[model samples]
Target: MTLTERLNQDMKTAMKEKDKLTLSVLRMVRSALKNKEIELKRPLDEEEALGVVSKELKQRKDSLHEFEQAGREDLAQKTRDEIAVLKQYLPEQLTEEELRQIVRETVAETGASSKADMGKVMKAIMPKVKGRADGKRVNRMVQEELQ
Candidate 1:
């Protein structure tokens, strides 16, 4: 099933199962998806839906960090729960080793021998990894490989 269909089904299930946390997270995601559709004046394709999910995940992660820094465990935990829910919609994440391998290959493919070539390497690699790897993690790995 498409991501949108799966999310709608899961939202209904969450409602029936009385899963408050899941229900709330799913509702937020649905709202984001709806907003994105309206913004584009069309329904999202799978990649666009994944982009929305990733954006939501990134926001939650940033909030989680801030909440933890502010010593608010309750808010941090809620953000973590939201992140877990959002993760269900992402492509399976690449392991560090796999990400490193891809970075190495990308470096070679782009002849990226130093930090100056970072942008070129990243531009070439992002499409391959897309939703599968965290951009920051990929960037770190690329820097390490280059050095």
Candidate 2:
């Protein structure tokens, strides 16, 4: 099934099971998906849905950090729960070694010789690693390789 269909089914199950945390997180995801569809005037494909999920997860992580900084453990915990639920939709993440290999390949493919070519390398690599690796981690790897 498509990601949207699967999410809808899970929403129903969550509602039936009275899983408030899961249901709330799922609803937020649904809203984000719906908003994107409305904005783009089309249904999202799996890749697009994955992108949305990644964006939401990043937002949750940032919010969790802010909450913690503000000494709001309860809110941070809620964001953590949401992040856990959202992560279920993402593909398996890349390992550090695998990420380094891909980064090396991308640098070679793009002929990126120095830190000055970081953008070129990143542009060539991000799409290949999308949803599979974190951007900051990839950036660090690229920098380390170039330097």
Candidate 3:
């Protein structure tokens, strides 16, 4: 199923189960997807839809750190819950070793030998790792491999 369809299906299931947290998160995500569709003036393909989901996941993860630092366990927990719901729409994440391996191979494939070649490496790697690995993590791994 398309991501939107999956979200719609799960949203209905959440409503039936009376799962407030999941239902709320799904509603917010659907709104985000709808907004993106409006902004682009066309329906988003699967990759674009996944990109939106990844952005939503990243926002929660970034805020999660702030919540912990501010001693807001309540907010942190809520963000964590939201992340859990968001992740259901994404593909399974790559393990650290798997990501490292991909980075190494991508760097080699792109003939990237120095830090200056980071852009080439990243451009080549992003599509291969899309939705499966965080971009920041991939960049860091590429940096490590190059150095």
Better of 1 and 2 by lDDT: 2
Candidate 1 lDDT over residue span 54-105, tens digit each: 8899899889999999999999988888899899999999988888888988
Give the best candidate by lDDT. 3
Prediction 1 TM-score vs. true? 0.95
Sorted by TM-score (best first), the order is: 2, 3, 1
- Compute the lDDT for candidate 1: 0.91
**Model 2, span 1-147: residue lDDT tens:** 989998999999999999999999899999999999999999888999999999999899889989999999999988888989999999999999999999999999999999999999999999998999989999999999999
Among the numbered candidates, top TM-score falls to 2
Cα error, residue 137 of model 1, in Å, equals 0.3
| TM-score of predicted structure 3 | 0.96
TM-score of 2: 0.97
- Per-model TM against the reference: 0.95, 0.97, 0.96
The whole-model C-alpha lDDT of candidate 2 against the native structure comes to: 0.94
Cα error, candidate 1, residue 61 (Å): 0.7
What is the per-residue lDDT of model 3 for residues 1-147, given as tens digits with 9 covering 90 to 100?
899999999999999999999999999999999999999999999999999999999999999999999999999999999999999999999999999989988988899899999999999999999999999999889999999
Give the Cα error of residue 61 in candidate 2, in Å: 0.7
Regions more than 4 Å wrong, model 3: none
